[model samples]
Target: MASLAAGASFAIQLFARVGATGTTLLRVGFASLLLIAFWRPWRVRWTGRQLLGVALFGLTLGGMNLTFYLSLRTIPLGVAIAIELLGPLAVAVTFSRRVHDFAWIAMAVAGIALLLPLGGFARTLDPVGLGWALAAGALWAGYIVVGQKVARGHPGPALGLGLLVGALIALPFGVAVAGANLLTPAMLGAGLALAVLSSAVPYSLEMYALRRLPPQTFGVLLSLEPVMGALSGWLFLHQRLAPIQWLAIGCVVIASCGVAAGAAGRAPEPVVGPEPP
Candidate 1:
């Protein structure tokens, strides 16, 4: 989580140099290469159904990255993340069986409402950016569901191949927009850093976590992402938040902690079968 936050900060800095699509391509592309080389995923013989699962996971993963980056173009990272979280919140609520879960979700909703530009220190944000963030959120939910299913197999092959698919989808768009700018030495260096911090490290951990955790638990736990994003934006991007927004973050954080506490002591779901040798 820390790695993802730090990577997002770096990505915002790189956006000034290469644009959103370029950054997405570089991050996903480099990450795919690194993971594939390390895991040597081709050693495992994948069944057709498993292959299809990875393809769907890759589609969601790629779409999520692309749309989230696009939102960052016009919105502050924290606000964008806060709005994007609605997807996970919805997922959590959908799977929730307890009353407290709904309460936590309501608190999260309150937090989101505080982020609205209706009044106070908040200003109107770009509708397009908000739309993109919402789209990213939907894809994020899809990624969580699909990732859990795929992670039941081998974490390495699923993540590496999924990223490769994403990189392929992003390649042409990145080329069309950034072109020669992306080839600069500085851009390459930054892109590598972004890939490591953003995609490679955190995603590996996320896949492992997804394999063990329930989807609703996984979704609610992601509330930390907004907090991390907000801090990173303030520290690195100098994007300050209003007092109300900070309170909003607090609400979500508390809600997440509550959910985590409730879920404590529960045994993780078992993996479907033995990992590929």
Candidate 2:
């Protein structure tokens, strides 16, 4: 929910003379710096395996932000988020044995089909944007997988290190695109806000939630993200969706909700880590 609000603000920031890459760099960079200061990752002794997991987690985190932001350049925020959600949806359903699980997956597929430019009604969406959203989805899946491995203990330090690695990965491209424009007061302020809203606060909340709730219940709550994104985009950015698009989003959301509910009785897993921004 917070990410949705932050993403709406980020869309506005993108129009403030900063490119998408630059915006991503600012977000990850500020998040890294702030977290590093607070968490003091240097104090933690890292094992070789832990270091590798953090690195992989960072790679997926960077890729997810980069591609999702790039997609926003050409697609509406709600639509992009709905498309990108396939990653987590896939993760949720991957190990399921229940017959109803496949039904949820089918419904999600149907929703995606409606979003595609396969018919005249859906032809307005940009193909390149769709591709970028799909790429983000793939990277999101990677983020969840690697995050589970790296989030075992000391989530704050692990996240701080991961953000640093992500910032390093994204910074060069941001510099190349936005150049000195990113250093302006307006951009810096907006970027800082983005980092706090999209990264710090949400990450902390998710980590806390994971510790207290079953993963399935948490997943069910997280399923509301697309709906929140849609509402936020509508209210903040005036990015209204068509009726069909709304229906499509509903299908995906329902599928996610169903999957989460089905798994709600399962035993809770140990805390892994916070999800990527």
Candidate 3:
């Protein structure tokens, strides 16, 4: 929920003349600095494979954030999130053996089909924006895979270092596009708030939750993210969706819930830390 609210704030930043790359850099960079200060990742000795895992994790994280923001530039927040959700859905289903799981997958497919702007709806969406959302979704799958690999080590230090790698990847592009505009006092303040809201606070809370909650419980909670995102977009950015779109969102949400419920019997997959805003 915190991440959802913070995600909505990106729309505000977008309208504030900061490019998507600039905002992504600020969010990841500031969060990295805070995490490094608190966790001091440098103290952790690393094997080559662990280092490589962190780098791949960071790349996926960076790509997810960058493409998500890019999609937000042209698509409504709820719609973009709904589309991007297919990545994690795909990940969940891949490990499932139950025949019923295909029903959930079908529901999600139906939802996506509704949003695809085909036939009479063809004029409703921007193709480039949809493409970016799909790209973000693919990166999100990569995030899950790489995140699992990185989680075998220290969570705090690994995350901090991974975030640093993401920051480094995004910084040059941010600087080029936003230039001195990114350095303005107003933008700086907003960026800091965004970082704390989207990354720091959420990461801390999620870590705490992971220690206490069952994976199934956590997955169930995580499934609400897109709904929260839509609500936040409506409340904060005034971005409203049509009735059919809302139904599509509901289908996706149902699919997520079904997957989470079915996965309860098995050992839980490693939880991905704070999601990209």
RMSD, every candidate, angstroms: 1.9, 3.4, 4.2
lDDT of 2 at 238: 73
Q: Is candidate 2 or candidate 3 better by lDDT?
A: 2
Candidate 2 regions with alpha-carbon error over 4 angstroms:
112-118, 208-223, 271-277
lDDT of 2 by residue, 1-277 (tens): 6574655556555654878889899888998899989888798888898888889988998888889899988886766776787786676567456788778777876776565545673688888988999999989777766675566666778888888899999999999999999999988998898888787777656655555554334433455666677677676767777788788778868877776777667766765544333
lDDT agreement with native, every candidate: 0.87, 0.75, 0.72
**TM-score for each prediction?**
0.94, 0.86, 0.84
User: What is the C-alpha lDDT profile of model 3 across 80-109, one tens digit per residue?
Assistant: 776786776666557446677767777777
Best by lDDT: 1
**By the TM-score metric, which is better: model 2 or model 3?**
2
Span of 10 residues, lowest total lDDT, candidate 3? 212-221
* Candidate 1 per-residue C-alpha lDDT over 41-80 given as tens digits, one digit per residue, 9 for 90 to 100: 8988899999999999999999999999999999877778
Task: Show model 3 residue runs off by greater than 4 Å.
Answer: 115-121, 203-223, 269-277
Query: Lowest summed lDDT over 10 consecutive residues: which window, candidate 1?
Result: 115-124
Could you tell which candidate, 1 or 3, scores higher by lDDT? 1
